[model samples]
Every structure is written in C-alpha cells, then in structure tokens.
Target: MAQTGTAGPASIATGPVTITEVVQSALRDYPQIHVSQEEFNASVANIRLARTAYLPRVDGLAQVNRATRNNIFGTLLPQNTIPSISGPVIGSNNGGSVWGSATGLLVSWQPFDFGLRHANVKAARAAKDKADASVQRSQLEVTTAAADAYLTLIAAKQIEKSAAAAVDNWDVLLRTIHALSSAQLRPGADESRIEAELAMARTQLVYARQADESGRATLVKFLSRTGDINTSLDTGRLLSELPPGGDEEVPFQTADHPVMAEQRANVAQSAAQLRATERSWVPQFNVEGAAYARGSGAEVDGHRLPGANGLAPTVQNYAAGVNITFPFMDFASIHAREAAQAATLRANQANEQLADKALQEQFAKAQAALRAAREVAANTPIEVKSAHMAFDQAKARYQAGLVPIDDLAQAQRLVVQAEIDDSIARLNVWRALLQFDAARGNIQPFLQAVNK
Candidate 1:
C-alpha cells in the first residue's frame, strides 16, 4: 500500500529535456552499467575454454643427465662382442653418455571421442549465446533503473513547485488581511490568523525543498557523478506536458524478455554439457612423430670407458594413423557427470519459469498503480479549486468579524493541504508512467506518446 506522492528526489537542471533523456544520460554514465558491460566481456573467456576441447593438443620434452653408474649395462653392441673387463675400476674414465638430446613433439586430435568433441562445441556455442543474452539483460536493467531515477526526480520537482505555490497563495492572503486590519476594516484577530497560516506554508515549502534536494542527490548518484547534495534543478520543462494514459492491458510475453531468454540459453548450455559428458565413452585419436639423437657408451660396475664417443644412432621415426578407443568401464563416473548436468538444466528451467511469473506480477502491479494514480489525478483539480474558494470566503468572514480567527486559519490549512494533495496526485501520474514503461520493457513509446 505504499503510495506514490508528489515528493521524490530532486529534479536535475536541463535546458529542455524529457524524462527519457535523463534516463538515457543515467544509463550511459552510471558506474553500475559499466561494471555489467565488463562482466559480459569477461564471460567470453568461458566460451574460449569450452571451444578449446576440439583443438589439437601438443607437448614437447627434453632432458640431460650426468650421474655415477653402479652396475652399468653395455650399449647396443654386436651379438658376438666379447666381454672386456677393465680391472679394479673404482672411478673409470670420463664416460658420460647423454640420452637423446631427445626433443620431440606429440600432437593429439580427438577424431571421435564418439561425439564428445561435437557436444563440447555445441555447449560452447550455447554458453556464448547465453553471454549475449546476459548483455541484453544488463542493458535492460540499467535502462530501467535510469527511468526510475528520472521519474523520482520529476516527482520531487513537482512537489517543490506545489509547495512554492502554496506559499505564494498564503503570502497574498497575509497581505490582504494585514491591509484590512490596518484600514480598521477588519478585526485584529484576522491578521494574526493569516500570519499563522503563512508560517505553516513557509514550513511546508522548506520540507518540499528538502525532498527535492534529496531527489537531486539520488539522480546525481544514479548518473555516477558527484555534485552538491543540496543542488536544485530548474525543471521548467518537466511539467510542460501531461503524460497520457499508458497501454496497461498488454499480456506478458516472455519470449522477448532478455532475462527469460538468458535463462533459456542457460538451460540449453547445460543440456549440451550433459550430452558432452555422455559422449565420454568414446576413445580419443591422435598422430605422433619423434626424432631423437644422443651420445652413448658402455660401463662396468662403477666404471666408465675412456673413449665414449660418437652420437647415439640417430633414430628419426614418424608415424601417423587412426587411433580408436572404447571405454572399458566408465559408466559410473560418466553417468554421474551427465546426471549432474541434467539436474542443473532442470533447475535453470524452473528458475526461468519463476522469473516469468515474477515479471507477470510486476506488470499487473504496475497497471494497477497506474489506474489508481489516474483516478486520484482525475479529482484533484476540482478539489483544489474548491478549497481555494472556501479559504477566500473564510478570510472575508473573519475580516467582517463574522467568524473567529481560528476558523480562518483552519480554512487556510485546508487550502494548503488540498494543494499538497493535487501536487502528489500529479507526481503519482509520472510515477505510474515510469512503472508502465518498465513493465513493457520499453519506455520510448511512452516518451513519444507524451511528446504528442
């Protein structure tokens, strides 16, 4: 039952711009919006990780060693070579043998991990799509926040104007009462009554100004700018045109909503992940080739040869062929992963449905608020005019000594309250307009309608 009153945040100064312009400005400049854009950009990295599964993987290796050998095995020698034992070799000659100055590259390509590669690719694409939808949702959120801030600022300005008007009306009555009393044409009590009313009017104006200042601060914050907290805006253009009735009867169509779209994309991505997990039963394929060469020698228990020379037989070998693998018994783990993904997909689906329902509720509530605001606004003008007339009669009666001073004061209070009500009603209309715009996922049409 929270009501939209004429009081809101302060109005910002503009040469001649509408609420839509303010909203655009806020969206473009807000820090929150920038943060969201950065998040969307970061999400692209997830897509890259997913896509990497399909690409070939390669590795290179190298090693060097110089160590004592206890019982050495002779090098690849001729089958007829006889055993020549060097006697009592404690530490033999410099017989350092280098295993392959062996540096080789191995490349692996999954020709058919069954459908694992394809499923990974699909999942990656889905994730990218979801990222895109997330960007849209962020945009919508920023735009909506900007619109709300703008509307609140407008309401504040309207309330300030109304309070100022009330003060002026009271000032005029004060002057009239003082003149009549000075001319000996009215009771002295009448002057005191007018003065009391004027004081209350001034107090109301101060309160209104405070509300307006608060609103302006909020607007500045929304724009991500620092400014004077008590700043005032020359909102002359805000009330230039009355906003028209908004389209409130449109049914909720979630297909076009960015939030729902993102959720759907998430579900799809999870499903693709499940498929990828299920495909894990297939074996991976690859092609490998290596060329290695290193020096060698023969040694006998803790002994080394004096002339351990020449590079080891250069073995340059290359082989390329199709490799197939079938999972022996991986059902338990693979199925578990797949099941987890499936559950996640279901959860996302449920979340999407919940979001849809929430949006529908928001739409309904906005429409109801708009209807109520319109009804309130409809009766405000007549009520304000009637209050003004009654105050005039009360003042005349007090001056002629036909009524007590308290009566005139009460009448003045009524007029001021009536003006407040009218101002609040007007501001409520603007608030309702914003709610309606947000509900529709578009505020441009509303702005155009107001312009016309």
Candidate 2:
C-alpha cells in the first residue's frame, strides 16, 4: 500500500515528490475513483432496499370527493382505465350528488416466500462486492498511469543530461581545435570539423530537452495540475542503481488481483441473480391487516343523504387475513427468465476464465521483458567504461600529433552514445518493473521496492 501524500496534487511543493506520493495523491481525487465509490454506495443502498422486503410495509390513504351517485348491477372486467365504485344494487336508477370522504391504512407482511427475499438480498450483496472490486480496479489503473508518466519524465531527464554533457564535451574540443589551429599546429580542417560536431551535439541536446519538456508536461497533467511548466524532479537516486528485485521474478499471484477479483465478483453476482430468479415463482404468503372507512352520498334505500351527511368517514371497519397466492399461469415467463439468467451466469463464468488466461499471458510477457531489460542494464556500464577509456586515449593521441581529429571525434561520439545507453538502460529496467507490476494488477509493491 502507498503511504498518503499531501492533500492534493494541485498544490505541489518545491521539493521533489516521490512516485508513491504523486500516485497516492491522484488516487485521492481522481474522478473515476469517486465514480466507482458512488456506484458501490448505490449498491449498498440496493442491498438495504432488498432487505426491506423482509419487513412489513404500511400504506395510508385519505380522499374526499363529490360525484353523482348511480346504481348498476352488471359486472365489469378488472381494469384501471375507469373508476371503481362499491355499492349494492338498488333495482332502480337515480342521479344525485353529495360529498364523500374516507381514510384508511393497510399493513402487509410476507411471513415467508420460502427464500426469494433472502436470495434477492444475497444478489444485492454480490452486486456490492462487484462494485467494490471495480473501485479497486480503477485505483490500480490510476496508479499504473501515474507510474508511467513519472518514469517517462525521469527517463527523458536522463537523456537530456547525457545530451547536455555531450554538447559540453564537443564545445570544449572545438575551442581546443581552434586554439591549436591558430597556433599553426593543427590544420584549419580540424577546427571546422570540431565546430560541425559541436553543432550536431547541440542539435541532439535540443531534441533531448524538448522530449524532457514534453514528458514533464505529461507528468504535470497526471499530477492533476494544469500547466506546461517544467516540473523539477529528483531523479538522481533513481538513476544510480536498479530497483531492488528488478532482476528476479515476483510470484505471479492473481487470485486476489483486482482484475481477477472483479471478474470473479461478476461471476458471483450472476450466480446470485440466477438463484434469485429460480426462487421467484414460489408461493407468496402474506399476512395483511387493514383498517378502513367508507363514505357514500347515496343511502342504502335509494335515497340521497342529507347535506354533509357523508362528507366524513362515519363508518369504519377492521379486517385481517393470512393470504397465500401463486401465479399459476406464470410458469412460461418464469422459466424463460430462469433460462436467461442461467445463460448469463455461464457467460460470466467464461469471462472470468478468459480474464485469468489473459493475465497469465501478460505476466509471462512482462517477465520476459524484465529479464531482457535487466541484462541490458547490467552490461551498459561496461560499454560506458570502455567508450570513455577509448575517448581519453584518442584525445591524448590527437593532442600529441599522433592521430587525426576525426579519430578523436569518432571516439567522442562513442562515449556520448555509451553514456546515453547507460542511463536509458537503467530506466528501461524501471519501465519493465512498471509493466511487471501493472500486469500483476497493482503497482504498490513495485513502488515500495523502488522508493526503498
């Protein structure tokens, strides 16, 4: 795990920030992290709602109306397109208007549904787990990105440092050749050649500086800051040696890795959903108690009630019953839903398997690349040492009038290349380590190793 950094990346201090600090800061406020967190919170709310199904529900209603009262005997189909009225047949029709009002409350509780409510709650919990895994995956992705940006800036700075050194060396050689030519010892061609070499070295320096600037801008973007201002970094220690354990293999543990865990959660969620669907068609057993009142403008003997006589709930009744009902004709739809949910569960399982396979392949590639980078990093110092020795000998010979300036220039080019290679070789290993950690679905372990 990464230690917490400052409050935010926007308020960068003058001192160099560590990679872990930068990444941890971004993790604190990155939009994706918050989005996933909110999703997890929503899933938690859903779990609460699902569990509410296990509790009793109470509803209250109150209404007042003035409408014409009439009587009829024929039955009408059960539907809501038209209003419903309840009264006995009067054997005669009349139209009269009066006030009516009523108020009531009903409480219904499902003593049990076998296990449907429990299965639904279980599915909600599984969904919450999936969302949590998604949050972890988002965090890991952000960490990987920050590591890439920071390392890119460091590598660019390394190249820029080497290019600047080459320019300085070439400029000094040019001045020496000019002085020697003026003293009538070296040829004028030596002065011209050294000048051209210095120009090329300066050009290389310009490109390296540009790269460094671009990389710094990217780093700034990742730091959640808004500007192209060149950010200063303390990369000296990072360039001095390979990170610990860069050459060795880390255990390719993936069961708890965020990617695998997220996929596994997906499978679990699907399985829970399937279970919920399977338990859905069971008999619905509910215990219901209702206390209600009725108000009617028409009397039972076909006479209109007096003014305001039915305006309030003057007649009330209480009823309670244990009702057991089943959707006898719902077999087809329930079967279809069950089949679809089962298929979804199977697909999620397959997806989990695929994620596992992909992770394994990616880990293998990362290991191979790390091995190659470590080997190159191990050998670049020798190349730098040999090139520097050759350049020194060539310079001595050129000054002693035993060799041409071209030979010394060639040796200088080799030394410059060797120096650049040496720095880049180490950075390459760091990048490889970054990939290794990314493939492992987390970067904290690598950050801890590097920072240590």
Candidate 3:
C-alpha cells in the first residue's frame, strides 16, 4: 500500500526545468563547461607574471677548482741571463697552486631606460585585458547555447503532444463514423476513409516522435553531457506557462553584447601593443659587478722559481660597471610589426561594426517572428472552431446519404489540417520566443515576469 501523506511517483519532477537550472546543471557536470573561467584565470596569472618585471632580481653563485703542473709556462726569458728580482726581465717560471673561493649576491633594477620597461608592462596589461574579454564572450556563447537547446527541447515536446492529440481526434472521428454506420445512416465507404485518416495520423505521430528525439539529442550534445536523449526530456513540463503576455519586445541595444565587448577589448589590446612597439626603440640600462683576489711573482736566471719568496697565489679583484643598450637597427622590423598590429586593430574595428549590424538585423527578425507568431496563436482558436463546424456539416450530410464519402473525407482533411496548423503556430511562437531570448541575453527575466 502507498504510504500516507507521501507523494506518488507521478508527482515527481525530473531533469532540468528552468533555463538557469539547465545551465547550472550542465556546467556542474561537464568538464568543457569551465573554458571561460579557465581563460579568465589564465589571463590573471599572465598579468601577475608581467608585474614581476617591476621587481628586482637576485641570484647566488658557487664553484670549485683543480691545479696542474705539466709544463706550465709563463712569460718568455732570454736564452741565458741572470737577472736581479728588480731588473727588467723577459721571462718567468710557473709552478704553484692557489685555493680561493667566494660567493655574492647580485641584484638588478630598471633604474631608467627611456620607456622600454614601461612599454613591456603596458603590453602585458593589454593582453591580460583582452584575455579577460575573451572569457566573457565565451561565457555569453555558452549561456546562449544552453538556453537555445532547452527551448528547442521544449518545442519538440509540444509538437509531439500536438501530434498525439491529432491522433486522438482522428480516432474519435473514426468511432463516430462507426456509430453512424450502425444506425444505418452512414455509408460503409466512410469507415474505410476514416481508417485511412487514422493511419495517416499515426504516421504523423511517428514522425513527431522522431523529431522530438532528434531535438533532445541535439540539446544534450550542446550541453556537453552524457545521457539517453530518448528518455531525458521532461514531457510533463513541456508547455509550462510562458510569459503572461502573448507579446514581448526584442532587444536592440549592444551595451551588453559579449561579442562587441570582445572586439572592443581587441582594439584596446592592439592599440596598447602598438604603443609598446613604438617605445621599443628606446635604450635600456643595467648594472653588474665581479670581485676577486690578486698576488705577485719572482724570477731567477732565465727562469722564475717555483713559489719564489713564498708568494705563489694570485690576488682577487673586484669590479662593478653599468651597461646601456639602444637599438641602432631593426627599425624596419619594428615598423612592420606596428603596421601588422594596426591592421589587426582595423580588422577588429570592422568586426565590431559587423557585430552591431548583425545585432540590428537579428533584433528585427526576432521581432517580426514574434509578432507573426502571436497573430497566429491569437486566431488559431477561431480557425479550429470553423474547421470543426465544417467537418460536422459534412459528416451529417454524408450520414443522411445527401453527400458522398469523398466529400466528407475532404472536410475531415480540412479539420486535421487546421489542427496541424494551429499546432505549428504554437510551436512557432515558442521558437520566436527562444530567438528573442538569444538576442536579448536569456529568458530568465521573461520567465520571472510570467511567474509574477
């Protein structure tokens, strides 16, 4: 027995419902969903790396040495000559070893170099900004795609329901024809015609199911998910109430468009790159130093004595100096790079313009589709009623033997066509709604309005 105060299986809601919910769920499970956030984080890391340029750098040093005494020659001496230690001799003997080592720290800072460092930092910052903007654009695209997929699923579900209803209506008409025949008022040929119509309706139902399944598959793929699309969609919630008003406006403003924002960022980045390149012609300055110990030597007749006077090791020395570098050539390459960046900037500008124009056209198209859909939906009820009345008149006349079964079948066909038309009109309204949502951003606000 079912538990008291417990909900039944039929009451449970399944899968994604709201667009926001769908997006959130898909992102939570899909690895590819984080591309935009990852891109933004990467840009932040690059910016941090670039900022390291402003900080001074320090390093350590170490080393070891070995001595050899194999024919170690020194300054040349005369063939045979005895000379005093203070005399101007031409030669010396070499045979000694020195054990010395030292360690020190070195630091360098860009004290001043025209504008080289500044330009590098500026370029890095521009690139970081561009990366950030790209992330935003990617995020917008994902959101739009998610919303579109969800809406498409909803539309397919609605069409399936319409097809099912159409089949049911045809079944009812067929049953009515049987009843009339039993009363001896309708021709037996009418039953055959109605059966044919029923078969057609079933075929349509099969096609509708296939279309709905195809739409669900597309939605799942777009969300980057793994699921059985045939069973994933929530048919029960397919026609959940839409925005209260049958009409809604299409947005035309571009202040929030991600593609436009990305283009603008590209332009700024390119401009900054150009500025950096222009500054590359400037000079750069750095300071360096080294220190060591030193020693002296003595001599004998045409030869220097080994460890003469016990002074065999060399003294260490210390040196410090500054270096300055300025580009004297490569101006041609620099100019070419600047030209390329300028061209990229122009291209980005053109892209921005194109995005604006595309937005305008999309806005107009969405508006037209929405308006047409509303008109069709508003008049569908009257069309359905008119078709029903015509079908009833034809049925009654045929039952009285005053009209042919073919005429009645034609009238029934008109009724079915009208029903199909109404269903298509409803589907079109939803399609238009989805398109408008894409153009404006998302349908969250509209959904909220409808709920309110």
Candidate 4:
C-alpha cells in the first residue's frame, strides 16, 4: 500500500502470505486504523462546521390567530412567560373576538469578526491534522505487529525443523548403540542415554510447535481473520540473507515520525483553541435585513373588521439594520478558558518533546541490536560447521571404542543446538532490521530490501 520501492515477485507476490501482502491486508482490515480514519472524517466535518460561521443565517416564520383586539397603556418588565402585542392601545378594553396574525423573514450575517471565525477554522483544521496523524500512526503500528508476528512464526518453524532433525539423529544413534549392545560391543547404558536425549529433542519440537501456533493466533488477530493462519508464507527471502546494511547511513529524523507529528498537531490545535478563545471577548457585529407581512380583523378604534380578514396578509413592511453586542461579564469566563488552553498547549508541547526523546532512544537501541544480530549471524555458520565436525569425530571414536558414550551424546546435542542457531541467525537479523525501521517511523526500506 505505502511502498517506498519496487519489490520483486519472490517476496511480494509468490507466497500465499507475503509480508507486504499481510501488512497491506492489516492496513485495510484493522479496526484501530478504521477507527482513526472515522475520527479524521469527523474532524473534517468539524472544519466545515466551523467555516459555516462565515455564512449568512436566514429564518422564516408564519402564524395566524383569533383573539380580542384590546390593549392597555402600561410599561411592563421583560419576562418570557407572557406574550406581547405590538398594536397601539385604545382607551377602552373590549373582549369581542376577532382574528389577528403576523409573519416575517429575517437574515443575519457577520461581515467581520476581527478574525475570530478564522481562528475557529484554524482550530478545527489542526484537530483534523491530529486525527490524520493518528491514522498514520495506527497504520504503522498494525503493520509492524503483522511483520513481527510473521517473523516470529518463521523463527518457530526453523526451531521446529531443527528439533525434529535432532530427534531423528538421536533415534539413529540409539539404534546403532542398541545393535552394539546386542553384540556385546557397547554398554547397555548407552542405549538408555540416547533414548533420553531423543525424548528431549522431541519435547523441544513440541514447544516449538506450540510457539508457532500461538504466533499464528496473534497474527490472525491483526489480520482480522477468523481462522488459524493456514496460508503458506514465503520466508525464503527473510532467511536467505540479511537486509543489506546500506540503510545504516541514513540519519534518524524525528520530525517526520507519526507519533511526533500527532503531538505537534495536538500542540497546534491547543494554540488555535487559545487564539479562538482570546478573540471571543471582542464585540460581536452583524448586519441584518428582514421583510414581513401582517394582517388583523380588528380596526384601531377597537372595532372588529370583516370575517376571515386576518386569514391572509393585508399589509407588508421591510427593515434593515446593524447590531453590535458585547457581554461585559464574559471576561471572567474567557480568562478561565484561555488559562486552560494555555496549560493544554504547554502540556502538548512537553509530550512532543517526550515523544522525540523516546523515538531517539528506540532508534539507538534498535541500531545496537541490529549490529549484534549481524555479528551473531556471521558467527553461527562457523559454529554449525565446527559442531558438525565434532559430532562426526565423536561418533567415529565411539564406534571405534576410543571414547565414552557421554562424549558422543554431548557432541550430538551440541550439533542440534548449533543447527538451530544457524537456522535462526539470519531471521534474527531481519527482526532487528524490522525494529530498527519501526523506531525510525518507516518500514518501507526494510520491506524493499526483503523484496530484493
């Protein structure tokens, strides 16, 4: 999905479950990645919602009513419970029923707000950026996990292979010792010892298979699949050679890391929120234009007009004005909010620094591990060769009655361990390389090298 270079079919397309294919599958199906993507979508919506503040607002209204057209002259304090009438008051009060109605349309818009709207939009955009970074971070996490599990399974497979081979060697040696004992050439105790060693090898093979099954279960979770990982993996490239050390020259860069980017986005979002709050205390200004129509069945002299006269509009009017409002007491609220946002901004900035440090430390550790793995990988072949030579010599000596059974048994065990070490040495190097690039916030180079 996010390839850095072209990879040949051997590593990317030949296997039933290639590393690239697994990573791409995880990216597509992982729930955490989808969650982050949804959050990003919501953040995008919030940006549009914030931008809506710059547009005009229009409201429509209509009404009809039948009531007595009576009015009294008196000043009343403002309250929400009672309805107010706008017509002039006559000297007398009359309850004679008549119909009355009114309707209007109002449009309000803020031509400017000293960049307050802009600050809100910026805040929303920063949140969107943070969510976007979170999505990238999640992708990296899932892919790293899939790759790790895949490699672990490969290691387990290698261990099992070696253990099985050990069991077979021990079995063959046991048969030979039994033959010698039957012929009165070797001690009967030699056969018992060989049996014990073969059992131990079988036990190790069982443990290796268990580890492999467990790894597959874990990998299946990342794949969001329902079954055990039954697909054949093309681990040949992973075991054939070490990921070339050419990438060792590229210096670690923290600024491009997704975790660092998310932290930075958090800080920016907090700063934007603070800016938006700072401008909230400024005066609110808006220009409004409205048009309306009204009708009534009663005349100004307290006389009822003709029937059904108020059912339709009989008069029309229009008005235009500007409004400016400032909440004098909002200063306290603004100060409290600004303080909170300032604290948040500082906290986010601190987290960003912490993330940077963490990435650097991880990279350092991974680099050291890679070097050690390479050294181990380079030395294992020699160990395997020596162990084979020693085992063969011991076997020959034991058959020639020149050495004790214990020496041959020890040599045989060493050969098995050596074989296992050789099998996993290259894989360990590949694992170290995976960790190295994971800490660097990009695994593309490692994946590309594997393809080669």
Best candidate according to TM-score = 4
Instruction: Note the Cα lDDT for every prediction shown.
Output: 0.68, 0.84, 0.64, 0.87
Model 4 agreement with the true structure over 1-452: per-residue lDDT tens digits: 12122222222223367777678767777677778888888899899999999999999999998887667788889999877876778765756878877799999999999999999999999999999888889888989998998899889889988888988999999999999999999988988989898898889889989988898787766554434357777885898887788776589999989999899989999999999999999898989999999988877777777768788878999999999999999999999999998998999899999999999999999999999999999999999999999999999999999999999999998999999999999999999999999998988988888888
**Mind sharing the TM-score for model 3?**
0.75
Candidate 4, TM-score vs. the true structure? 0.88
Q: For residues 366-415, what per-residue lDDT tens digits would candidate 1 score against the true structure? A: 88898988888888889889988988898788767798778877887788
Ranking by lDDT: 4, 2, 1, 3
By TM-score, how accurate is candidate 1?
Answer: 0.76
**Against the true structure, candidate 4 has what lDDT?**
0.87
Identify the leading candidate in terms of lDDT. Answer: 4
At residue 29, what lDDT does model 3 achieve? 38
Extract clashing residue pairs from model 1.
9-215, 10-215, 10-216
Worst 10 residues of 2 by lDDT: 1-10
* Candidate 3 residue lDDT tens string, 302-366: 33235332233354556677878877897888989889878988988888898888877877888
Structural RMSD, model 1: 8.5
Model 3 is weakest, by summed lDDT over 10 consecutive residues, at: 1-10
C-alpha lDDT (0 to 100) for residue 57 of candidate 2:
91
Query: Over the stretch 228-273, how does candidate 2's per-residue lDDT look in tens digits?
Result: 3454666644677787773356578779689998999899999999
